[model samples]
Target: MSFVAPWFLVALLLVPAAAAVYVWWERRRTRGAEPWATAPLMPSVTRGGSRRHRHVAPAIYLLAAAVLIVALARPQHDVTKKIEQATVMLVTDRSGSMRSADLKPNRMEAVKAAASSFLDQVPAQIRVGALAFNQKTKLLASPTTDRARVKNALNTLTGAGSTATGDALAAALAIVRPQGAAGVQTPAAVVLLSDGANVRGRDPIALARRAGRLKVPVYTIALGTDEGTLTSKRANGTTKTERVPPDREAMRQIADASGGTTSDAPTTEALQAVYKRLGSAVAEQPGKDQLTSLPVGIALVLLVVGAGVSLRLTGRIV
Candidate 1:
């Protein structure tokens, strides 16, 4: 919650001041009546209500005053709203390094699970696209509301060639970018997952800069631990084991350039968590909602109830 007119909040002191004044008046009246009547007879003279019941109406009025002061401050809070016609591109790396067994059965398999979770978390109104990249980028499915098609495309991905992070991001931008600027109001975003540095195709940082220019944010996830390794067989017989750690710095740079977030998922659980957050982020945006009327309504109701109680108990409304 936030306040637009914070200065008005100082007026809240008036509530406590009013309470003190009411307390002083009640004590002074009681003392002044002591000369005319004894304490026992004072209750009979007051008649309609007990001392406790008499305070109820004043207490309610004080509450109303406090709430009304809050209303004057102009409070606001964050509210989530679904983005209509929003397009999100899910780009996953199918590079040989993704075949590493650091994350359970394999990195690629875990990525598939996380991507499926992302699809499930995203709202049905959002259009999602699937893209897999290795030595080149492949658009398995264009942006569509059909989750089955995108999931099927994700399932087809397998660890293969070199990483082409830049090219994959570029391909996504081409699909989500507005045609002739007429559809510019439609929101578009890209989520790129990779386990290694760019080894082929275009420069990813450059493409991320282009995405920034197009007002499309590109979220980058660097998956895989420092100890991650990939084993490949040589033509002659023996296998060559090579360390293929995720390029976290590169991912961070890409996200920063595109005005998006960067996440390092060294394990499958962390990757899934990252995707879950991204799913909500891409589907809905936070909007500021003014809550001034809420307190104002509450205050009005409190005042009306307070007035009615005072009139019924004391034959006068304060």
Candidate 2:
């Protein structure tokens, strides 16, 4: 618990002071009272009522004052809440290298399965977008809460052409940037799944720096093994084998530049684990909640109880 106006707590000293004054006055009035003659002859004179019950109302009143004083301080508590309005841009590399038979049936198929599972795990309220990049980058789906649309876009992705990692990042950033109401940017994240290094378009590192300036972290997942190979079809209909190993160094650099983390997923299971972790990371948001109303409500209840008890016991409300 914390207080916004902590200085208001100084008023709490008045409660104890009021109690002390009541005690002193009661003692003084008792000392100055006339003594009844033959008081020892009557048992009721010495045992009129329970002393504990006599002080209950006063104690309650004092507690009520203390509670009210605390409420004036504007107490607050830390709370972790789900970010319902946050946007997550899924940037996938559909370059020809993603067809390498390094993970399961193929890198692209494994990624699509893992990505779909990730979508299912994330909160339904969180807006998700998808972008596919190869020799060129294009927005497959704009950010929206329609899970069906995002999933459909992922299913339509086909691996072909060269890698354009920089263009993909730029496109994802554009989709995740601040929009609508007051131009205030919502909390956002980018999940980039790639298997090979950039071979065309702009430099990925430069675009990563831009994303960093915009405060958008790009989590990079390098998927594939060092022995990964791809079979390419030539113009003459001949097939040629080519090495398409995972570009861990390039992915790590991009993640670092954009204030994000990089993970190496050499297997389909590892890729799913990465997506699950990202789902949790992107869901929770930390904030402070004022607790003044709680203390205020407690004080009101105490005041009512004190008044009722005083009237029932003393024939007058305090």
Please give the lDDT score at residue 301 for candidate 1: 98
Candidate 1: misplaced stretches above 4 Å? 1-80, 178-183, 286-318
Which candidate leads the pack in TM-score? 1
Model 2 steric clash pairs: none
Tens-place lDDT per residue, model 1, 133-157, is 9988899999999999999889988
lDDT for 144 in candidate 2 is 89
- Candidate 1, pairs of clashing residues: none
For model 2, how does the per-residue alpha-carbon lDDT over 1-318 read when each residue is reduced to its tens digit?
A: 889999999998899899999889756654444265354533334323354566788899999999999999999999997887898999999988888888998888998899888898889889899999998998899998888888888988878889989989988887788442237777888999899889888899998988887777899999999999998788999999988898999999999999889999999899999998888877765678999899899999999999888787765775
Worst 10 residues of 1 by lDDT: 178-187
Go through the candidates in order and give each one's C-alpha lDDT. Answer: 0.91, 0.86
lDDT of 1 at 96: 90
Clash numbers, per candidate? 0, 0
